[model samples]
Target chain A: MTGDGVLAQALRYLNDPLSWTAPGGILDLTGQHLVMSVLAALLAAAVALPLGAWLGHAGRGAAVVVALSNTSRALPTLAVILLLATAGLFGDTATVLAAALFAVPVLLVGAYEGVRGADPAARDAARGLGMPGGRVLWQVELPLAVPLLAAGVRTAVVQVVATVPLAALAGGGGLGHVIAFGMGTQRYGQVLAGGLLVAALCLVVDGLLALAQRFAVPRPLRARAAATAAR
Target chain B: MPGNPWFSLEWVRANADVLATRSWQHLLLTLEAVAIAAAVAVPLALLVGRRRRAAGAVVGTASVLYTVPSLALFAVLAPLLGIGRTPVLVGLVVYALLVILRQTLAGLQSVDPAALDAARGLGYGPAQVTLRVQLPAALPAVVSGLRLATVTTVALVTVGVVVGYGGLGQLMFEGFRNNFHRAEITTATLACLLMALVLDTLLWAAGRAATPWLRGRADGGRRAGHGQPARASVRAGTGTDLGADGRGEAA
Candidate 1:
């Protein structure tokens, strides 16, 4: 096909109203993608955050933390998804689990490092102020750790969004269906459009998370960063 | 029991040859992708390292490339590159660039300014200073990046099964496609994970051997306190820190 034809076909597929209107249309698929991605990220954060933070605060299980994080990073996510789907977990569940598994390492590492890396003087001052250990953790450590936590969450979310398309391979539904369908029928236009949408969604989410990370920084730290930038 | 297709000992015994071939394919694919990615990422990072001003743009582009979905990228590349090793190789190479590039840039930039000054004072020219001092200092950091990229690429190479070029991934896909055969799927999964661990360990060993000074430095910096060991460039304490990123403060 000519370059112009390829571009025209992709644009036509994207601009078509029908692509946005159905039970399985682009809009619907996008919603599915978002739901799967968000749920998986939330699940990962739920498990990773408390455990990682506690481990970091206790200063124990450093080996376990390192091993777990590395294992998660090294897991072949698509393989896991296929295995899970074939294992009878079924549809979106397998996808979500795969995405969650993919997300856990980054979030876990972030939380662990964020808490462990906190300024000891500030932590000590909190203890000296007669604050309970739990109170110190909540009021002092968590706030300071927010920026790293946000960064981790941002990375996790983008990864999950990108990964959810793999679900289509397992007969799970999402934007990947478009690409899969296009592939089956040699409809390069649909494939291009679907891929672009997934990429665009990732970038949009990345931008939002960057903004959130900016806001998550403590005021003093933000001011310091600003000062440093100015210098 | 032999009646069970999914998890039969017989099935695994029968598929030994399949496993070996697929594992070899996976290894070759991962090695090629990482090699290409390093070739591209190092020079680009070196350029950015020297310029400093271009670091943001280079890293940003790498990030965007990383954000592209692996499966989608395969689909897009398949029509152009044709379905086989080429598309998968391209996709894996793309995925690797971000981590490797970031680490290289961070490593090169992290070279001590005082050392650079000393080199200059000692009559070293710009190229000499970069070649003699900066590159040596940055080696550990760059190796750390390579370790991360290598592990990640191993994982990603499996996804190329979608385009019919996955190494062990293809075996796993076949297991799934052919009626969820338990033994086939389970064996393939184990093999994939095992390969990942083995490869990661190999790279880890290489990093250790390459940076023997890290251990000595760790001993020297022990008394300087909690964070100082990590900040000491080459140290056992800094190994994990280096594995991720260069910033000692951020972890």
Candidate 2:
């Protein structure tokens, strides 16, 4: 219970290779966390699209979506999982829903803003070129909005990946099992070790995104400005 | 749908004291975490913003922290700290780093580099330049980041229920646990929503107040014509500090 005891024990757990080599260890979590994280990002992006993009583009009654997103933002993942899980949904569905909800408001805000903030002049020019509204949205608007979409997806990835550990609480499983076990046993070393491991996972995912994110950046951002200048 | 447990104003009114007490406790928890988060994040952000490579590394670290699952983080912390405010506060501080670092970087980066050179030419040392020029220029972004942190912390602090700290989350979780439909669930849910709205508005106002030069009265036309000051640009569903640069134009 003392800080010294806890710190020493925690370090011991982290340093012990046997813990990992043992039957159920960090490796068990890798697959599910990966699945849940990606699923969370995809679910957040998908939900925010029509709901966020339409609201962003439509230009009226938009506050409703904003309000809803904000409201979702208010509800914590614990509250949502507890509520939904109690209603009979469990495991992956519960984790995904919790992660998706955690992600939605922020994702929607990005989607909405990215769409609304799309260069008006660019849209006008695309329309002038005879692009239909749908074509304009798909070709011009979405292209320009890709960065924002990517940005939202990136946010969801981090949020979902980090938070999926929460699934363990409801028996959904992930690094959360490590975390919850550590807590339940009053094993401070195990808790910090679990936390540190989860935190490391977050860093790896973020690093992967930094590289992957460039693909989502708008084409204009990618074009060498000097090359275009020379042209 | 038929039961509609949360719709009765009279029922909620009867428990106004309980609801209000929980709201205040929730608010206090949020404010405490935010205050601590700002203390650590702002200073660190200023320091990192000076070096490009370092900033990237720091930002990378923040992303990892920002996305941490609250349930697990708290669960991990709770056993060591053994429940209640301390562990939760620590988590919020970590969460704030994710936003604060990225936003602070954005604000600092956005400053016309020319301005810094001018300050240097005027004989400002690195310290003077940072305190006077860099910090001021970055203030708007800093405040915006703070706002995002505030909104986010307010939302997540509700998870403090996992540790049995007992705030509005207690009501929300209890409602969920007992299947106490409308009265408990309804009351807690509405309180959370209202608190979120109120906290968001307060943070938005705080951002504008902090950065008057950015939201100059002339920009009143911008507000009237466009929308509210694009404070934090948090894309609700996603967990990235992406808004830091997403609508750089809007910010």
Candidate 3:
């Protein structure tokens, strides 16, 4: 019997009805991946957004933000996940927390930079209008900073999705299971299918977020940019 | 009580040989991957930087390549390469490409346009202007990019344990498999982080030392002190060309 190429094997696996509808099928795996990634992103944002924004508003902690982000780049997410999972936490929880930590530095950096880079004239004007400092931050700075904040979140989400497969190593379920199982059993096609699925998910999410960012940007800013280009 | 397994001196003493071997393997693997990445990225960045129009496409491609999941890349490569050092090395090289490529392009374009004009005025040829004027000015950004890429690659080497590469990740996997042996996990984690930090600091120092001219310009002939060079403020654009403005403070 002739062996199929990886591409051919992947197509066969993907085309099989059982692969989609059977227990722990492709659709199920996709759902697991999405849930795990979104959970991680939300968790990261919950922690990073407040601290970053507060720091930006107060004009303090830039050093801390820089230090945290730099140190984070030097730490491996999978190792953290492994350490946590081995400590008897639920595999998924460990993976989510680890991924959240990985996601934080980017989100925090984005929030801080965006707010810090907000238009000083606008900020002063808001203050001149007798707005409280907190009000100015929430009402003026954050709205103007939406584009950058969205970009950060978008990047973090895509990364978290991609990293979620590491969880499969600790017995947490995701598309990584398909890849790992294929590797163990020499099912090259299953591996390909899993990889293709992940890539497709990343592209789709990124495209959607790009579209969202376009809409998320303040309408006035977009019009001004367009008008400037026209001139 | 057996004390904290993670901090166990006995466990570390027992596994000293393996730990030392794996750390060396990890360092070598990271160096090889970064070297290959820099070689490819530099030429490609120079080509793309010259065109300006190709900047978007080049950066976009690298970003997309980077977004390919690490394990997924390994899985895809394993079918053809059979899960060993080759696949791991290739995966890491691709991973490092975006950061290095983006940095190089940014560095090349960061040269002051006035400087380029001055070089041309002095009868310098295109190649001479690029090498003498542009590259020298772009040094800080490029070196900064290289430093970031090296650190990132070092951390990522730990992921190669899945593909059977014996980096520090091998220790991580071993510790993981043996019911989370504390000493093993803690030691591997510390070693990996330390390597990344030490390598980053060394690269940072090397960058500073290599660009004495930048410091001279920043200091305006004042004896250099511990303060960072003013050129350090130039934001290395990852995709967008900051152009003349990026070097605004460099002067």
Candidate 4:
């Protein structure tokens, strides 16, 4: 069968070894994508987690958390990147900064909700057992909050990974570069191939994170979550 | 001479027509995508309601679709749809589906079982029960979903510049392409944020107006007992709770 269709052509592009190993090829772009996603996620987690967890443990700032999460949904990632680029940051720096901003609210919300939603009985029992505030947060609350924390990171990472492709629009490097280059040159096949690569990367990252989320929870907590889900 | 300011009134005046056109296109695209998504997702949600396996499968697929980056979705569709409003519109609908579907399902599931039973005992057919009891009760969650979807679509519409239909996105990108025109980029970006805020507020108001019972409790039931107070708080918190839920599944 002739291979003139977009999918076939895209597959052909994917099949080419040069596409993987050449300078600025798929592998190179994929690495850039992963690096941006990971760095952005780490930056977001570093800032959002401690603040969110502290606020949640204190049982304060519920309204702030709620409002922040709501407003975050309205911030466009593309606009964010362009705004940053215009502000003098360029290349991967702007991409990561924009992505971290995009990733922050979910992580913060997740951290807050996870810690706050921890079992009150468990927290009280730990308190009653003469545990200090810091100890309670570390030993009891943090462990219980693991599932939601993991889920939050997973969401943030997937979002970052997905969004890093937009860096191409700002003249940054990533899998999006291939797609952007193709679009500019009218090479539909390359665009499709790049799109496929990005999509595949997102799925793989998400799946791995889902597994991590499952394994991060204590067995008892996992069972309880399953039971609640079932009910 | 000093550089151009980030918010130059001159630039706004110079490009007033294009800015207005782009902003209108942005709003129109968001509305079309969200309207189509709601029409499809509501029916799909109702059909899959209370069916554990089917809901899982349908939502699972939608979530996978959601995981695909907006830019990639546009790129993939461009080859098939030939790069225009259609691909961008299709991408927006796909992005909105998971959010709307999951919330719609959650809303349907949240309908009090007792209410359903009462409707049944009153000789209401399944259709009537769904239309009269379930839909009304589930309105809050559905509306929350719409709010999230609309805001998200407003943002995603900016990404449509890739396919040449990104509404305000075109302005933002153009601002960048034009030697990083600070005024143009800042203006378009702020416009998107403003549009999203306005749309979200409008939807929240509409949700409240649609659910008069919720307003009645919040406004007039200040001393309406412990259970009433708790329930009122839960209803008030439903939007954010559902927002978190949608984002969780979206990833």
Candidate 5:
């Protein structure tokens, strides 16, 4: 603790009250980061969820879903942000749009796989019980697909949160502003502190979503998942 | 036409040399990172083979590393390594580790138990069984992991711009800094996307070539039952289907 190592300095920087309550303090930046990430995720889910679910239910376009998921992984967030921002979009709008575009493939693939992987037996039972096709999809398939769908959302949210930092490079607001500022000034301690903050945020968000994923599944499905894990 | 257009053939024609250099750098950096990651991850996976506690610990630590943003990781490393390709390379390798390690372990675990038994019955030693029997069988999954890692590395190499080593990302950054040079940004971005797709197709073809037996299975009914679930699970984000499928086959 006495040594003036980079880690020690970073720890000191994080501990100071000034870092938390300054004009663009950690708290302020964190709020910006979360807002952008959440908005982008919601935007992505609105489009991806319904489309993926409908496609999965219809048992169509599985190949396209797989292809999109693979291709999206290769689309750099930095490139996307730069493209949109330079294409005449406003800074915050560009950031949100890029993040939403990055999140879509994961959500789409998740919803598609979730609904497609639903138990055929349950669907058959619902059909036999005089449920219409639409009712069977609503009552049987969607519920069964909840776990995987939540998992996808969890992954997408974490990824978007992680990538939001790149928005700073494009003149947008976020915790990335802290890192970008540190980099500009060659302040290693501040840079490390910013990195730590972003990493911590990502882990916390991921952990919360992981818990949500666990709880979102129907009780019976949760029990079955637990049983499978136990086995 | 009302300011600079999104794309311009003249700009691309003039900057062709710069574009090629950046594209090559991007490709080289991606290949190096993934190759190094595969080298490290495969050995680590083999060392931790079949050990549940060790595998859990290793993968848990890796997933934590994986969750850190690329820019943040580069920032943290820049202090230690000094701004350059080394830190970016190290960061890229770290990001690739979780995907590659998980895939390798999953692949090794997916090897048929009967194959191992057969190797042993023929007086094969443990090392021999691992090398001669298991490795070949797990090749498909390992290649699959490599494909994921490679694609991820290609995307991530752009973040290296934080340390001034972001390959095509540097061009994208430059475009933004230079009053939003539309053609420059569009060209670089498209190049990144094109590189990713082309690399993926190449890897997929290589995987197909390396595993000829799977082609035979492709022509059989079991193909639907075997391939679809694994592909679905991978895309769905669980990525645990290789091991699960092996266990199911054994059962």
Candidate 6:
């Protein structure tokens, strides 16, 4: 199609939110994907954060956990969705599994890094004060690592937002529906608009994550400043 | 359990040439994506480094790019780019952004301030200082970014299988679709892990090589080595950067 046609198609998509959200219309690209993504990220955080924290705090197991998570991350996400999809987990179940698997590395690593990188002296001081392992972790380690944990969760959420669209092919719903519709028809504009929206959403999520990080974490080391200073 | 019958030694040996072809194609696909990623990320980072505020913008944009769920992202682009390697590379490049930007910024950030001043005091222009002083300092970070990008690219390369490439993920996709089960899935999984691990180690070493600082090299040996360091050069690192970005310190 000509440029005008493409533009018109794209505009049509943007203007027609109803087309995307009208109850199973256009693959349920509305809040369904976001809900799925957030839930997936939370699931990832739930498992990875605690496990990562344990591994990180234990001091000796950090490498093992990191290695395992790192390896798990190698599992192609699309493959994960496909595998889960065929397992009859599309819709709710697929999103959950995909998010859980995808989120693990982020939360695990972030939590581990957050806690491990905390001021050792602080940990020492906490221990000296007779804090039990549970208390130290809950009160000290987790708090110190809150920002990192949040960062990891933010990453997982963003990933899930981007990823759950694949569920459309499996009968799950979200922005991927827009993409699939466009693809089925060889419509570039639809794809572009759909992709653009997804990217924009991800960017928004990333920006929010940055905001969360700034508040959750202490004063961030300004890399720009550091870069200049280092030079 | 990890060993599946479909990927039996017999099947592999019988089709060793075919497997090799797939391996090579996969390797080239990954490297092409990574090479393009390095090319784009490093220079962009340098530009960003020159203007600190913009670097954040670049990285911010990149992190968002990282989150585009691979297959769906590819499917979205399939109409425009026409699948195969094009969209995959596009996706991979976007993924590389956070890594490249962060490392570029990191490399610039990691530079020794005193050295920059010395270069400037010697009447060096902006160009000279960046080339002779700042770039060298940022090398380690650039290297680190490249290293991360390499591993990420390796992992994400499998996404290409969705659009009809025969990478390891293709095997997994086929296995899953045809009901070859975990045995078949295990091959793809192991292949991915092996590829990621091997590449990670190589790049980890390369990152050290890239970043003289990471290696704690002394004297002139540090600056001249590993080119400009990927920290200064590579702008993309992803899980496919796995959505790692400068989560900002404000929170």
* Model 5: how far residue B8 lies from native, Å: 1.9
| Docking quality band of candidate 6, CAPRI definitions | acceptable
DockQ values of all predictions: 0.46, 0.29, 0.38, 0.55, 0.46, 0.32
Give DockQ: model 4: 0.55
lDDT accuracy of residue A25 in candidate 2: 72
Clashing pairs for predicted structure model 4, backbone only: B160-B166, B161-B166
Cα displacement (Å) at residue A127, model 2: 3.5
Chain B TM-score of candidate 1 stands at 0.84
lDDT of 1 by residue, B1-251 (tens): 34535467777778789889998998899888898988998878776788756887776677667767788788777666666899899988887777777777777766889999999999998889878888777766667667777777888887787677888888877877777666676777777778777876776677667666665754432212112222334434533331221111122
- Binned by DockQ into CAPRI classes (incorrect, acceptable, medium, high), candidate 2 is acceptable
**How does model 1 score on DockQ?**
0.46
Candidate 4, residues A76-149, lDDT tens digits: the string is 88888887887889868899998898788888877887787788999999999999999988899989887767
Model 5 DockQ reads 0.46
Ranking by TM-score: 4, 5, 3, 1, 6, 2
Candidate 1 residue runs with Cα over 4 Å from true position = A1-5, A223-231, B1-7, B219-251
Please list all clashing residue pairs in model 3, or write none if there are none: B5-B183, B6-B182, B6-B183
- Which runs in model 4 stand beyond 4 Å of their true positions? A1-4, A227-231, B219-251
**Who wins the DockQ comparison?**
4
Task: Report the CA-based lDDT of candidate 2 relative to the real structure.
Answer: 0.67
Give the winner by TM-score: 1 or 6: 1
- The residue-by-residue lDDT of candidate 6 on B1-251, one tens digit each, is 34435336665566567556666776787777777878877777777786767867766565445555565566555555665667777877766655666667766865777898888899999889988888776665566566566666776777666455647767666666665454455556566667767776676666565554445423223332221233222322211111222221111
Q: Which ten residues in a row have the lowest lDDT in candidate 4 chain B?
A: B221-230
Model 1 lDDT, residue A180, Cα: 76
- Please report, as a residue range, the 10-residue window in candidate 6 chain B with the lowest summed lDDT: B238-247
Query: Global lDDT for candidate 1?
Result: 0.73
- The alpha-carbon lDDT assigned to residue A153 of candidate 4 equals 82
Q: What is the Cα-based lDDT of residue A188 in candidate 1?
A: 74
Which interface RMSD values do the candidates have, in the order shown? 4.4, 6.3, 7.4, 3.3, 6.5, 5.4
Candidate 5: which pairs clash? Answer: none
Error of 3 at B147 (Å): 1.0
Flag the better candidate by DockQ, 3 or 5.
Answer: 5
